[model samples]
Target: MAGAEDAGERADRFLAARFDGVSRSRIKGLIEGGAVTVDGATLSDPSLRVKAGQTFAIVVPEPEPAEPEAQDIRLAVVYEDEEVIVVDKPAGMVVHPAPGNPDRTLVNALLAHCGASLRGIGGVRRPGIVHRIDKDTSGLLVAAKSEPALTGLQRQFADHSARRSYLAVVWGVPNPLAGEIEGDIGRHPVDRQRMAIVARGGRPALTRYRTIRRVGSRASLLECRLATGRTHQIRVHLAARGHPLVGDPVYGRTRGARNAGADAAARAALAGFSRQALHAATLGFSHPITGKWLEFESPLPEDMGTLLARLELI
Candidate 1:
């Protein structure tokens, strides 16, 4: 409960603030489980309006144990060592299991490949995972197989020492060609599913972008480097600049090819595109256990390559 000060706010919003490490979806789960009550009646809705002075009682259950089943999934191994493993993750592969994606993740693959050693190294559920790239954004990701590697990699990520570069095809060509995007990113006010630039209660984010190739005057290929890693940082920052990546479902234009001055073939291809035109092209970090500096680069996926080919000839 948020007391009397925040009377009219949505229940999920205030509950999210009050409950640390609990997401809005988790709060809805509590509401569904009859864990929230007010005035002796259980609240069944997550959107209940709270009048001033009405107290809400909540019962939060203990976190469920995370035990993911291993599967014989194929992995595109980039580089591997006794302490760490790097894989060039294809688009559409989840790094770890979550609510909607329960199994068949990178964790499952790692478990099947590494056996018991992969468990309890990083954390439960997502063992051996360090950082994450979005499922639709293909790229290179490194996972630690031991405690020392985990701790070292976590420290590097916390201090923003890990380097990540992404390649994106935005709908419009930016005027400056190359620059930095600085903002405070947080949950969108109205749309909880998306991140946005907010004035308060946001983490500082920075993205540096340079134009690699111009797809005519309306679209361009860019290389974006991250100084800070926030959820959807590159996508949000580029969208905020009015140059959202092509085929981005949440933060991009639907008729982007028309805006890109494309011909009929290109426009049809753009319309048929399924995922964001972004890829994690490069990654660099110090070896967690060996103290060796390591870097890896991935070529654009076939889909992005085909999309670019269509746009370039337009």
Candidate 2:
């Protein structure tokens, strides 16, 4: 039953507020899928206004079987124990299945590797996923093998206690060399497909960055530490600061065009780069069951290393 305070609130928003751990977007998806009812009548409008004291019911369907098929995809296993498995995910691999990418994901590979151990960890579709990195960003990620591990790892991430760091090659060196980017991030008002630093109604995000090396004024290698794990945090924050990553398709156009004045060698190097120059270099967390601290590191992938070498030569 909706209380007096929820009177006139949108149905999706009302249900989202009443239910904990459920996102408003998920609630809307459920409503649109015809899984919610009001007074026993199915309602699909997410924006329907709620009346005080009205009864609402939601039907939670049994989780569907994960559709992704396991394949013998190669994975770079970093560290593994009975509770968790850490992998150095390469670039261009989707972390999980989605609309366009339904197979050949890290989840599919894990299913094959872990077999029945991953049966009930994250959900049918997600399996052991606790966090995710972008498709083009390569780095270290840890997956839970057991229910306790999943719950523990999730709590650590939620509390912002886990340490996640990345290395990125941005177009130009930041003036200060070391600082933090603080902003509220949400979906772009105009572009819908990309994230942006919003003026209002966005989640708080923070990133700390320092220059690791400078490539003669044309570019800089930077190390970034995440304080909050918002989607596209590092990419969006760096772009907002006028230093979009090299080879970042969505955010690098302006900076790339500006770099046209660079010498021929630098131009060629940038042109040869095919994906964003970002890598998840390090990850640290407590073992879910052992109560011991564990940290793992991955070196820059071959392509990024080659780009750096070229930049240095120029």
Candidate number achieving the greatest lDDT relative to the actual structure: 2
Compose the digit string of candidate 2's lDDT tens values, residues 1-314. Answer: 99899899999999999888888998887786777999889886888899998898887655555467877899999998777999999999999876446678998898888776664654563356889999999999999988889999999999988999999998877978999999999987765458899999789999999999897557899999999999999999999998898888887766453663256877778766788899999999999888899999999999999888877766
Report the poorest 10 consecutive residues by lDDT, candidate 2.
253-262
Candidate 1's TM-score: 0.80
Task: Give candidates' CA RMSD values in order.
Answer: 5.8, 8.4
Candidate of highest TM-score: 1
Rate residue 249 of model 2 by lDDT: 86
Model 2 misplaced regions, further than 4 Å: 1-65, 122-126, 255-257, 260-263
